[model samples]
Target: MSKPPLIPFSTTLFVRDTCLCLHVQRAARALARRFDEALRPLDITNGQFSLLMSLNRPEPPSMSAVASLLAMDRTTLTAALKPLERRGLLETFVDAQDRRLRRLRLTETGERLLAEAVPIWKQTHAAIDAHLGEAASDRLRAELLALT
Candidate 1:
């Protein structure tokens, strides 16, 4: 086949500079790195911290609810839960009222670890907010929520 027409270099530059999805992904990865580093002393990834925090509730939440809140599929959430479960940080059990539903809860160990992690998370978040300025940080959160 004949060679296809090449996309112009300027078009590539335009997309690189202006693509919202690309920018968001880059920012997310950077933020994840920052949080991961901050949480590393606790032997937890940023994702795990978020997962554990979600499980802190008066009643255990259904697996589907946690998955939805985390924007993860069931299988991915299940895989993510395995490490925490193995560590005895959280547990998954069949719902008492609904045998078909599985629910998740943080164990006492998980709760304590999460409690410790909160200060670290808060410190990191405060630094980030300060860097962004409180108003800008709030606006960015609002914009991100709107996108979601």
Candidate 2:
């Protein structure tokens, strides 16, 4: 059999430096870590904080609504709800008008916890925005929203 040629190392370097998906993933992970650390004292992960925050609405949100906002599938959203439910931070119940649908809402305890988390989130977020500068941060957010 004839030997096959290997891909050039320069090609590897090019992708490493210029791949948008790779860069975005790396930045997302770093941001998650930063937020996770900031929220550590509250015993919540960044994902948990976001989930709890999403439930803060005038009326409870349907499972599909919450899932869509979080960009998660039903199964994944359901699984994520379990820990918070167990903690008495939130509740999920069958919809009154539609027995087959589930709706989620923050419990009183969840609201209190989220209240404590907000200042921490604000401080951490402000620091990050400062690092990026006001204009760059605004532009970056606009670009990210455009992508989604």
Off by over 4 Å in 1: 1-5
Predicted structure 2: lDDT: 0.96
lDDT of predicted model 1 = 0.96
Q: Model-by-model lDDT, in order?
A: 0.96, 0.96
- Per-candidate TM equals 0.96, 0.96
What tens digits encode model 1's per-residue C-alpha lDDT throughout 1-148?
9775598788999999999999999999999999999999999999999999999989999999999999999999999999999999999999888899999999989999999999999999999999999999999999999998
The total of clashing pairs for model 1 equals: 0
Error of 1 at 47 (Å): 0.6
Per-residue lDDT value at 148 in model 2: 92
Model 1: worst 10 consecutive residues (lDDT sum): 2-11
- Give per-residue lDDT, candidate 2, residue 1: 100
Candidate 2, 1-148: lDDT as tens digits? 9775598788999999999999999999999999999999999999999999999999999999999999999999999999999999999999999999999999999999999999999999999999999899999999999999
Instruction: Give the clashing pairs for model 1.
Output: none
